[model samples]
Target chain A: MIHRFLFHDINEGLIRHAKRYVLVVIVVVITCSMIDSMSAYFMDYFGEYWSPIEYGINEFYGRYPFVFDINSTDKFTIPFGWVLIYLFLAYMIGDYIYKDMNGYGMYMMIKSKKRWYWWISKCLWCVAVNVFYFGLLWISNIAYSWMKHGDIAFYQESDLRMSYYGFGFDNMGMPKLLLVVIVMPLLVGIVQSILQITLTLIFNSVATMTIIAGILMLSCYYGSIYIPHSYAMLIRYFSNESDPDFVAVDAGTGIAVLGIGIVAMVVMGYMIFRKKNVISNR
Target chain B: MKIELKNISKVIKKNNVLEDINYTFTGGCVYGLIGKNGCGKTMLMRLIAGLIYPTSGSVCINDKILGKDISFPDSIGILIENPEFLNDYTGFENLKLLAGLQKNVDEQEIKDTLTSVGLDYNDKRKFYKYSLGMRQRLGIAAAIMGKPEIILMDEPINAIDEDGVAIIRDLIRGLVDKNRIIIIACHDKEEMDYLADKKILMSSGKIVKEMIV
Candidate 1:
């Protein structure tokens, strides 16, 4: 029954506007490939010159007291590359799924009857699309690595060493650096889908979505800067590091956070949609 | 099988769009709801569809308040203003999706509804390419696809050509004769005259006249 519903929902949007959706996907794929290639070129040339040893040491002593140093060589490039890929795909997926105007302040589609069913189906679709996008990044990363260094195992030793030192990717037993590159941005995308759906339900406009995204970005910026030491430590402890065991523990924590964030957003979105009026804005 | 609204009022941003409206629509009759633009025809239909809430009063269908029942009256179908649709789907596909929303409706029924609305079901052309008249017919087709006992349509005749209007007139008339209650919210006097057994008029958020045509 759920599959039937999902089939209808997905085909309903895709069948009517297949050309438009296809066009969007094409644009996204091309843009992502270009950006990935450029970044790979730059990293190959400049990555070795940027080092986080000094920054990490200073922060460890509390003199340059940031929770995490953003410049660690293994710490930065791998995650940064993953994030760029995730974000590029997220933006494309969001464009395909969200019916808001093209960066304008209007939501052309309104939730009418079958509100819960539609919401759930769309949420599942977003997740599926994002996962597929993440898969693409994984594939592309392998391909790019092979192209750049003539070896698919370009970063294998670095990934293993970073995991051993307790400073690397931490999700699902993957290399800590790789996990950060992929998981963190994917989590952010999932959260964004939840947030956009909820705000659209509550306020019923694309304008509201923009405003909400702005508020959230600002809050996250400030929160990251001023978070207490205890909370920072908790985040750092859960972060991918050079130790394999710690990486495993932190990976579990990251998965838990992702699950909780998705559930919370979905529950909140469903409640708001169920109760809110389906008033026509036009 | 019956719908009743008691003292229903809707206030949005300090403007009362619907005010102190008390109305009852029993089984097996066609009602024409006539009003000027902004006079709450669409608002009242949405309220009845359980798509919107009134600030005061209650909407009861078959002795149960909307939102309290396990399902909205399995017999009620609605086409609110502007004939909103999943624009990405073909006309047939759109109707098929709506058909799944109800109970016991089959593919044949959906195909029949499309035919009755003068839509070619086998064609794979998307609804976005359809003419306004075709889109309106598709919307009506969706509303009546389940053979609902009570059908609510807002401006069912707008944007359609004369031939399209005639098709809707015949469809509504046939449904009414089958003992279904059809409420059509429209400004087209010819359509109301052809289909409505009774007519209700509104102005500035209140019912000003009720006449049996």
Candidate 2:
């Protein structure tokens, strides 16, 4: 029963808070589709006409011993489409986390008694939104592929793999992608929310929270970049291997990381919320 | 229903905003919280609303701490600060969203609240298009829509016109008669003088006066 309330509250919060961004999300979707369409067109033209010219140039330069053959229609469409899809999902999830942290919306959800229900519902809703968006992309891609190559067999024949499409359709796929998209953003949002609520309690100004968020983002970015190559390689080895066994290991590790991050965030956010003084809004 | 604050004190960065305050408000009374700017009137109200926690005290409603309970005051309505609304939403849309927070608050109740507050429910204008006075009326409409047991308002009459104020005054009276707790935080002596059954005055975060008006 409590879970039901939390679920309803979570949905209410998303509708009240995140609904305002529907326009922006739609614009992003349209922009992504257009970019995908243009890139596909370019790749098609390049494969059909420019490949022979490039092969001749490389042959004359003596850097290439053989002229490489390029297919006029490849299945993979520049991977820009996938990247844009990921980015759009990231933006929506990131914005939701950001606003919730900033104390703009979701105040009531955060206040609800069923904490786990609220957290899980939010996670699921974000994933659902992402799935709906990526589904649109898949449909567009299929349509474009049909128009360009005349049949599904052409796509199958191409060397290019529709790996991302497979990723989107698998049972555990959307959840894994959502885990990735929300992990870092939600971590940062949770930390920022905690720091904001704490600082607001102590300093009583909204500007302090903004400044802290900016500093935290910058430091995290630079800190990640400066990690030693050996450490980077170790981190990469855990998730980047292509073997089937390694893929399972990678997914398990990813889920564990996501679970830990989310749990830590909720605990911290709850502690801070409990201690926060709901002084009059300035 | 009753709200109790025991020895509540708040200090932000060594600046004391509220100091060792104790008060209890039972159901069925209209309270006017009067104080100068920075006297911690707003902070006190927030404490009651469970928006913020005091530095070293407890706020309880109906013998339960706010965060511990499954629900907050079962039905408590509040309009803090400027009575924030989504700027892009229509007045009716905003009311609908907030009213849906509780059970059994029908569309007719929402329409009636808007009408009683002197707002045209059918107007196509968004909340951003409303004048200052109109916004106040809309805020009142939202506060009353849920038929909450307790209503908290902060300067609800700040930007309202005389007619709007009169309507609000009567609305508070009506709410009180219905055995609801109505708490208004304001500095306007004239309005407070007319509406408040009890006045609690504060200065520099301490209660300077408490009088039955």
Candidate 3:
């Protein structure tokens, strides 16, 4: 019986929270503009029609040949716009549990009789919202590609990627493209969102957002296999074959890292929320 | 059923919201908690509801320690401070949303609860469009909907008209059973006298007086 109640709460939390999808729409608009600029760049430079998968790869591709030298005179450029998509996504899912705890969520918790259930519900809520957000991004990219190119193709122009991104698709099949474009983004998004949700309990939303921004910036600057955000960038994948100046991480390892990250955040969030006080609009 | 609060005190930012409150609430009666503003009536209710943990003590419901043995009461409903719901949903829709969680109250029960609280279940207006009185009515309805074992309402009658108050009083009166416990925090003495079987007066976060009505 309790299991049923928990399931219903999770389902309800996800559905009811969809009212905030307006934030998702805002991010989607920003992403669409970013894609447009990238498409125009490829059109002008490569003089070739690119596929949707290539467009997605470029948007997630942070600075290639990234090297952080403390003593060097050259300043490292971070992708502020790319980081904003993550920040905005985090902002969208951030206040949900907090606001609900003050308002309707408290009532639900009291009735449900298990605080862990609430945490689990919010974790799943994060996953669902991230999936939907990334789904729209992918769909928007595909729609743009369909309008420009006549086919919904996964084929990539290896020469163009090598020249511009310092990486080339090495006989990348459909499965690998799907993994890089769709699965990697979705996994990284869920991991970061869960981390943000867990951190909001300790820090205020602004502080938590700063922390998330820091993580994203660090991910953009460093291409270490350990950094979870590195998986989001297709150009950093070893299978994709990047220039020797860049560090390459396997997609399987990225999946494992992000998967572990999601688990860790979920468990940590439940631990903090178990004894949390559901005060008024805190 | 019984709820025991032992040395229950809550300090938020070093301000003593509740100070060493030791009280026992038994079933089958209405408890009217009377207190002045900031005297910790709502905070006490929050502790009992297991929404907040007591700094120095514990709240135990039916021998299960809250925050240790259970996160909240087994079956409970509450309307604390200003009632909040989804702004875009109607009164019925809001109640339905909460009711969907427990699955204890059916559709008809929800409609009947709304009617008892002087709200039309079929009202088409969203909650944001609801007047103050209507919002209070909806809050009351939500608190009492599932016939939960424990019902906590901080200000169930705030913004209600005299007629609406009478209706709520009778509705609450009819809700009493041997298995239920209802705690209402109200400032009106006459209303407390009329509705509650026991009146517990509080000041400075302590129960200063307890009288049997």
Q: Which candidate is the best by lDDT?
A: 3
Distance from true location, Cα of A96 in model 1, Å: 7.1
- Give the TM-score comparing model 1 with the true structure, all chains together: 0.75
What does candidate 2's lDDT look like per residue over B1-213, in tens digits?
Answer: 788888999888788899999898887788999988999988887767666667788778878876566334556667766665656678987776655555667888889989988898898898888998888888777777767777888898879888888888888787884467889987789889988899999999998888998
Ranking by lDDT: 3, 1, 2
Q: What is the DockQ (computed on Cα atoms) for candidate 1? A: 0.33
- If the candidates were sorted by their TM-score against the true structure, best first, what order would they fall in? 3, 1, 2
Top-DockQ candidate index: 3
lDDT of 3 by residue, A1-282 (tens): 344434544454556666666555555456556656655776567776667777677667655545556867767777655676677788667666677777777766776677776778778777777877777677777776776676678665676666655556665666886788778988999998889888888778888889998888778766687788888876676532424566578888888888888898898888888878878425
Error of 3 at A189 (Å): 0.2
Q: Output the worst ten-in-a-row residue range by lDDT, candidate 3 chain A.
A: A1-10
What's the CA error at residue B128 for candidate 1, in Å? 2.5
- TM-score of candidate 2 against the unseen true structure: 0.64
Superior by lDDT: candidate 1 or candidate 2: 1
In the range A65-175, model 2's lDDT, one tens digit per residue, is 111238434232222222233333344444343334333233333234233443454445544554444444344434444454454331221111122111211233445
Per-residue error at B107 for model 2, in Å?
A: 2.1
lDDT of 1 by residue, B40-122 (tens): 88888877877677889988987888765622454667775556566567887776655655566889998898999888899
Tens digit per residue, CA lDDT, model 3, B1-213: 899999998888889888989999999999999989999898899889888899899899999999999888988888876798778789998888778777678999999999989889999999999999998899888888888989998888899999999999998888788888899999888888998999999999999899999
